[model samples]
Target: MAHDHHEHDDSCGDECGHNHDHSHEHNPTDELVTVRDLIRYATSRFNRNKLVFGHGLQDAYDEAVYLVLHTLHLPIDRLEPFLDACIPTDERTEVLEIIHRRSDERIPAAYLTGEAWLGEFRFTVDERVIIPRSFCAEALADGLSPWIDDASQVTRALDLCTGSGCLAIVMAHCFPSAQIDAIDLSPDALEVARINVEDYGLQDSIRLIQSDVFSALKDERYDLIVSNPPYVTAASVDALPPEYLHEPAMALGAGEDGMEIVRRILRDAHQRLTPNGILLIEVGHNRAEFEAAFPALEPVWLTTTSEEEKLLLLRADQLAA
Candidate 1:
C-alpha cells in the first residue's frame, strides 16, 4: 500500500492531466490503485499548486484526505480502515478529475463537495452563499455558558446575516425552548438557508426572514444575538484568495474599514436586546478598527480554537452606554 509522493505540476497550459501519458489505464487488477495512492497523488498536486486552504480545513494532508473520501462517499473522519482499500476504477477516474479541478481551477473543496462542517454540525453549502466557517459556531456550541448567567433563561435568539441558517439551526439544537429568527438580504442565500432549515427539520423553531440587517424587525427583542456579519474591508476583499472570491462579495465586505454594517448593528442593538442580553459578533482581524470605532463600549473578546480575541461579546448596559 505504499504510495509515490511525487510532486505533480499540472499548470501546463494545455491538456489538464486527464489523459495519462503512461499505459496505466486504470486496470484495477493490473495496476492496483489504493486509497493511499490517491491521497499521496492528491497531496502532491495540492502542494505543487499551492492551493489556499481556509474554508473548512487548513492543511494539505487533511484536505487531500477529505477530497478523496468525500468524492468516493467514504467515511471522512475514519480513514485508517480504508487506506489499503482499492478504489474502484470508475470512481477513481471521478476522484482524480475532482482533485485536478481543485488544483488547476483553484475551486474550494467545500464547493466541490457541497457541504461544510461547523462544530460537529454538517451544513449544505453552495456558491449561493459563503461556506460556513465561523468562530461563532464554536462559541455557541460551548452553550455560551461561559458568559450567559443562566443559559435556560435565554428564550429568544437572533442570527443576523445568517448564511445557510447554520447558526440559527445550531441555536435551535442548543436551546430547545428558545425561538430563533434568522435574517439575510439575498433571496438566493435565503433559498439555500431555507433548504438547510428544512434539512435540519427546524422549521418550527427557527424562522427565516429576508432583510438587510435589522430593517425587517421593528420591536422584536432577543435575549441572545449572535452574528457573523460582513466585516471584511474593501481592501481585504480585493486581497482575498481565489477561493474567497468564489463566495458572494456581499457576504464579505462591509465598507472601507469593514465596520459599516457593524456600526448599524451597534446603533440599534441597545433597543433590540432585553435587559442583560448578550451580543456576540465575529470581526476577523478587524479588531483594530473595532477598538477605534467604539472605544467607550467594553467588548469582552471571546476565543475559539480558530482565532483569539476576534469574536466580541458585549452586554446591553455597555452597548446602551
Candidate 2:
C-alpha cells in the first residue's frame, strides 16, 4: 500500500488509547516548563500509555520532541540550543493539549499536527492522504544514485499512484531538469497532493492527474518511472493497527496476494518507458511475493534504513510489455 513509515520497535495494542498510566512525575499542568521538560513528560506519557510509534518518529523521546517543537514553530533539528529555553505558559498549554490528543485520540502524529516529513521536506497531510512516509523519499534524497545509470539523462519522469505527491515533489527537487506527472485514482489524495505541489511552488515542474495508473498517460514516455502503489493484502489490512486505520484504504489494499496494482504496473510500464528508462517501485513487505510473481525478470533490489522498503529496479527492455 502506501509507505506507512511504521517502526517495528513498538506496536499499538488494540486498547492502546484506552489505557493511560499517569505515573510520570510531570503533570500537564506542571508549573514553570521548558521545551525539554514538555518533551520528557510527553514521551513518558506516550510510553506509559503504550501508544504506537511510526507515523513520524520511532520512539517516544523523538516523537515528543518533534510534536513540541513543530507545534511551537521552533526548528526541530536545532533543539539542542533551546532544550532549556522556558516555554511560554500559553504555548505550553497549547502543546500539551495536542500531546493529550496524540495519545487519547490514537491518531498519528502527522495527522494530529497536519504535517509530515519526507526527510527535510515538509508536506501538508490529513486523513485524506496517507502520510508521506515512503522509503522512496530516502531513495530520492540519495539522488537515486545507486540505481540510475545517469541522473542527467532523466529529463522526464512519472510518479504513479503518487499519494500526497511526496515522491513527485521530492524527485522534482532532486532532479531539477525533470518534469514529473503524478497520477492517482482518488480525488481526495490528489487534492492533498495539489496543496503540497503548490506549497513547494513546483506547479510548473510537477503536474497532478487523477488516473487509476497509466490510463491517462497514453503514449507519453519517461526516462524514469517510479511508483509506490498499493501492495497490502486484504489479510494484512484487517490485521493492521488502529493507527493505520486512520489512513485511506485505497492507498493500502491490493488484491488477494497484494500484487494487483503492481502487476499491472509491471505489465504496462514498458510502453511508457524510454529505451534506457528505469522503473523503480516500492513493494514494501511483499518482497517474496514480487520475486515469485516475476520469476524470469530479475529486479535490482534497493535497500534503505527503513525495513519496510522493498524497492526494486528494472530497465525498460527487461520489462518487455
Candidate 3:
C-alpha cells in the first residue's frame, strides 16, 4: 500500500461516475453514512490514489478509526460495534473529515490524532516531541537490566531527553524499587511526558524535570542513565519525509555530523553514572559515525530486528580511562 495520493488522477469520480459537489454541504445528516461506510470510502480513496505503504491502507484506516473514536472519547475496540449500531449523522461527518485529512494530506496518524502508544502505554503527543520509538523498551522487557557498582546500588534511574516520558515510565514500572527522573530540555516536550507519567500512575515513582542534559542534574547521579538523544545529522534531517518535519527539530538534529549531542553525553555520562553503571543510547543509522569518532570507546552494539536502529551500550568503567 502506498500513502502517496499523487498516484491517481482527480478527474475520476465515485464508482458511479457521478461527480458529487462537496460545496454547499452544511447539514451532515444530509449524508447519513455509517462509520463502516466512511472507512470503506476512505480506504477506497486511499487505495485509488496509492497513498500508503505496505499495509498503508490498513494502518491509515486503523489510525482514522482511532482518531475518530478519540475525538468522541470512545474506546477503539468498541468503535466498529458502535459504527454498526447507530452513529449520529454529525459524528459520521466529523470522522469523515478527519479521515479525508489523513488520506489526502499524508499527515502522520500520530500527529493527526495527537497520541501514540509505547508498549501498553498511550501518550499525549504532538510536534513538540518525536513519536515514541525507543528500542530501550526491548532492553527493559528482556531484562537486559543495567548493572550498578558495589558502592552505589541501583536506587534511581534517569531517562535523559525523555520525549513523551515513555522510557521514564517504563523504567519506573520495570524497576519499582528505584526512583525515575524524566528530564528534557524542551518544556513543551516535558508537558507531553508529564501526561504519560500521570496516565500510568507512575507520578509517585517518576519525576518530570526540565534540564539540558546534566545541567539541572546538579549533584544528582544515577545507577542507570539512558537517552535516545537527537542524533540525526543536518543533511539527514533535510532528506527526511515531510511527516518528519512535523516533529520537533530539537528532538531530531544534533549537529552537522549528528554526534554533537551524543559525544557530549558520552563524555559527561561517566560523571553522572554511578560506578559500574550503564548508559544506553540509540544512534539510529549513525552507529558507524559514532564508532569512527570514538575508536577508543568500545561501546557494545545492541542487536535488534529493526534495521534502522543502532543502539549502543556503554559502561561507566569503560570511560574511567
Candidate 4:
C-alpha cells in the first residue's frame, strides 16, 4: 500500500511483465471471452477485493465498464453495442492484467488510464495532480445562474488550488469573455495543469500560476473566485482508502479539522474580490466544521446532481460586511 509511486509507461506492464501485442493470441482463462464476460469478471474481483471507487466513478460495475471500454479502445460511454462482442485472445490478457493491477495495487482508474473527464471535457492526468472530481464543475457548467445573473460580465476569475487546471479550463468555456488565473502551490501539479490548459487550446484564456493561494497575484481582483481546496482533515486523510492515497498528499489534506486552507481563503477573499464579485468554495463534507469556524458568516449552499450542500457561495459584500 505504498502511496509514493509513478505511473508506469507501459500501462502496468512494467510491473506485470505482460506482452501487449494485440495480434498475438494468449488466453489465461476460457471464460473471459466477450466484453460482457470481462466486465462481470472484473466487477466480481473488484467487489470481492473491496476496492474503493469515487475518483470519477461510483461503483464496481461502472469502474469495470470504464476499464474494459478504455482498454479495448471502445467508446467509454457506449457499452451495450459491444457488450457481447468477443474480445481477442491477446487483448483479453491486456485487459485482465489491468484488472489485476487495479484490484491488487488499488490504483485509481484515472491514474491507470492517464485521463479523466468532467462532463464532456477530457484531461490528461497523472500522479502529479489529484483526479479532477469537483462539484464546482457542475456549478460552472450551469453558469452560476441567478447568483451571477450574467456570465459575460465575469471579466476576471480565479481558481485556487487549481490542480490539473480542470476547473479553470471549464471556466474558460463557461465564461468565454473572462480571463482566468489558475493557481496551485505544487510546481509539479502546475505542470500537469499546464498540459490540460494547453490541451483545451486555452493557453490565452487560462493562465496557470504557482502560488500559495493568492500570494502570487498581488492586488489583482477577480469577479469570481472559486476553490476546491484541500479540505480533507488529518484523520480522514489517514483513514482514506488505498485508491485515495494514490493522489498527491499535499493536494488532499488540510490541517486538523480540514479548515486550515479554507481559513486563509476566507481571510483574504474580501480584499481580492471586486465589489460585486462572488466567492465559491467546495468544502466537501466539512459543513459542520465550516459552520463552527465562521458562525457569523452565512453562505448560500449550492446543490449539485450528486450531493446536497456540496458547495458554498458568498458574495463580496457578505465577506466584507
Candidate 5:
C-alpha cells in the first residue's frame, strides 16, 4: 500500500467546507440546537462524508457527542441530560470549528481533541500515535481474567510497542500483582504513554522504557506479552480513509509486506518469554499474510465483531524450536 499523505487545501465551498458561518440565527440553526441538536448535525455531516465505515447514523451521533463532551472534558454520561444546558458563545464557536475540521479536513476527533478513551483508561493522544481502539481492551477488561488460570501467578507482563500505554494500564488493572514493562521505540510516543501511566496511577506498577522491541528487554522475561503493532501494508495504507491520515504513518505502516514488525516479534518472542508465557498480538486482517510467513506455527486465531481484527494467541512452549 502507498504511504503518501492526503492533503486538503480547504478549498471546498461553505456547504462542504469549514467556512460555513454557524453564528447567525437565520443559518437554519435547528430552532432548538441543543447539545442533542449539535450532535445530530455533526453526525449527519460525518456520515454524509463517510467518516465512519458501517457505522449507522446513531453511531455517528454518539461519536460526535462523545467527541464534543470529551473535548470539553465532560463525562459522556453527562451529555444527554445537559443537552439544553447553555453553551457559551465562545465554546459554541470552538465546537463549530471542530465540527468543520472533522467534516472538511477529515481530521479524526481523537486527533483533533488530542485525547482518546480505551476501556476505562483515557490518554492524551495526537498524530504521534494511533487512536487506541484495540479489541485487546475487551480481552483485558474481561479480567484478562478469562485467559489466565491464576492471576496471582503472573509476576511480569509486557506491553510491547506500548503506544499511549492503554494496554499496559489495562494489564496493570487486571493483574494487580503483576508488574508491567511498557516498551516503545518512539520517544514522542513514549511521552504520550507517560501521561497515561501517571494518569492511571500505574507509574509504580508499569515501567516505561524506551527501546526498539527486545533491544531494551535484553534478558528480561515475562509471563504475558501483548501487542497491537502496526500491520498496514503499502496497498492498504493507500486505500485508508481520510480520518486515518490524522494518525502517524510509522504507527500504521509495516512496510511492503506488512509483516516487518510481526516477523521480528515472532523471532525474538521466545527468548523473552518465561516457561509458561503467553503472547497475544492483534494482527487485524493481516492473518493470511501472518500465517503465510509462519506456516510451521499454528497460532490460535481469535475474532471479534470488528471485521478488521484477528487476534492470535501463542504460547512460549509452542515457540520452542
Candidate 6:
C-alpha cells in the first residue's frame, strides 16, 4: 500500500498527440471559455505531466473538478449544473494559474487549496503540517466500537503526531466528554493545529503541545492514546514524488526501517495508560516491519472502510504482558 505516489501511463502524451513541451504555456483567455473547458484542459494537462495525486483526491479528473469548482467559488458537489456556464475572464485566469501550479510545481491539492477534508470534517492546512489523512479518523468516527463500548467513558485521550490537530478535534466530537491532548514535534505544525482547534471551537476540550513523541508528557495518563506517526521508511521517503516533497520531511520519515518512533512509543506507552486504557496507532503500509520489530506482542487489527490492517488496537493488559 504505497501512499505517496500513484502510477500513471507514460505513453499517454504520445498516443493522444498532446504536446509535452514544458516551455510553452497555454493562454486560458484564448483557449478556455467554459467551466467544462477548464476542467477538460486541467485534467489532460495533469495526465500529460504525470502529476501525482495522493494528497486529498485520487485521480486527475476528481482533482481537476475540485480545483476548478473551488477556484470559481462554486459548490463543489454540484458540478453538473455549472459545467456549461461561462467563466468570467478574471476567474478563468485564476483557475488556469492554480491548475498550472498543480501541474508544473506538483503541489498537493490540500496545500494549494489551504484546506483538507477527512470524512465530513474539514480543517485548515498548509505546508507546515502533513495533509490530514488517517484510518484513525474512520475508527474514531465509528466510536471505536466493541472495544470502546461507551464513548463517554473515555474521560481523557491523546493524539500523538497530531499534525493540524484534525484527529484530536474528531476525538472531541466522538467522545464529547473527553479532554484531548494533541502532540507534535514541530512548533509550526502545532501552530496550524491551534488554528484548527479554535476553528472548531474546541479550545477548552483539546490542547496542543509540541514534543518529540511523548517526551514532554511527564506524568500525564490517558484512557486512550491514538497516533498516526511518521512511518515511511528512509528509502520510501527518498523515492516519493515531487508532490510529497512539498510536505515537511520530518513528518514523513521515521528512520531506516520506519520503526524508530514506533519503538519509542511502545517502550513508554504502558506506563502512561490507565489500567483499562487502550492504544491505537496507524502504521500505513509498515505492518510487516512492525511485526518483525515486535514479534512477541500481539495487537488486534481494527477494520476500516478504506484499508486493511492499517490500524492496530492494544489493550492495557496486553500492553502490560
Number of the top candidate by lDDT?
4
- Stretches of candidate 4 exceeding 4 Å from the true structure: 1-28
Tens digit per residue, CA lDDT, model 3, 106-193: 6667777777776565678877888887778776665454343231255788998998898887777666788888889999998888
Write candidate 2's Cα lDDT for 10-95 as tens digits.
32333322233557665435642577668888999898988887676888888898899789876677566667666666888899
Off by over 4 Å in 1: 1-32
Residues 32-102 of candidate 1: C-alpha lDDT, one tens digit per residue = 26777789888988999888999989888889999998998766776776776666679888998899889
Query: 136 in model 1: Cα distance from truth in Å?
Result: 0.7
lDDT of 4 by residue, 1-321 (tens): 112322332222123333345666755565566788799999999999999898989899999999998999877876666776677678988999899999999999999999999988899999999999999999998899988888999999999999999999999998999999999999999999999988889999988899999888889999999999999999999899999988999998999999999999999999999999999999999999899999999999998886558799999999994
lDDT of each: 0.86, 0.84, 0.73, 0.90, 0.77, 0.88
| lDDT score of residue 214 within candidate 4 | 88
> How much does candidate 3 score in TM-score?
0.78
Full-model lDDT, candidate 4: 0.90
- Given candidate 5, what's the lDDT at residue 211? 87
The true-versus-predicted C-alpha distance at residue 70 of model 6, in Å, is 0.7
What clash pairs does model 3 have?
1-52, 1-53, 2-51, 2-52, 3-51, 3-52, 4-51
Per-residue C-alpha lDDT of model 5 across residues 261-305, encoded as one tens digit per residue: 998899989998999899999888888888888999998776665
Once fitted onto the true fold, the runs of candidate 2 whose alpha carbons sit more than 4 angstroms away are 1-28, 307-309
Which model is ahead, 2 or 6, in terms of TM-score?
6
174-243 per-residue lDDT for model 6 (tens digits):
9999999999999999999999999999999998988898899889999999999999999999899999
Better by lDDT, candidate 4 or 1: 4
318, model 5: CA deviation in Å?
A: 0.7
lDDT (C-alpha) at residue 268 in model 1: 92
Select the stronger candidate by lDDT from 4 and 5: 4
Q: Give the least accurate 10-residue stretch of model 3, judged by summed lDDT.
A: 1-10
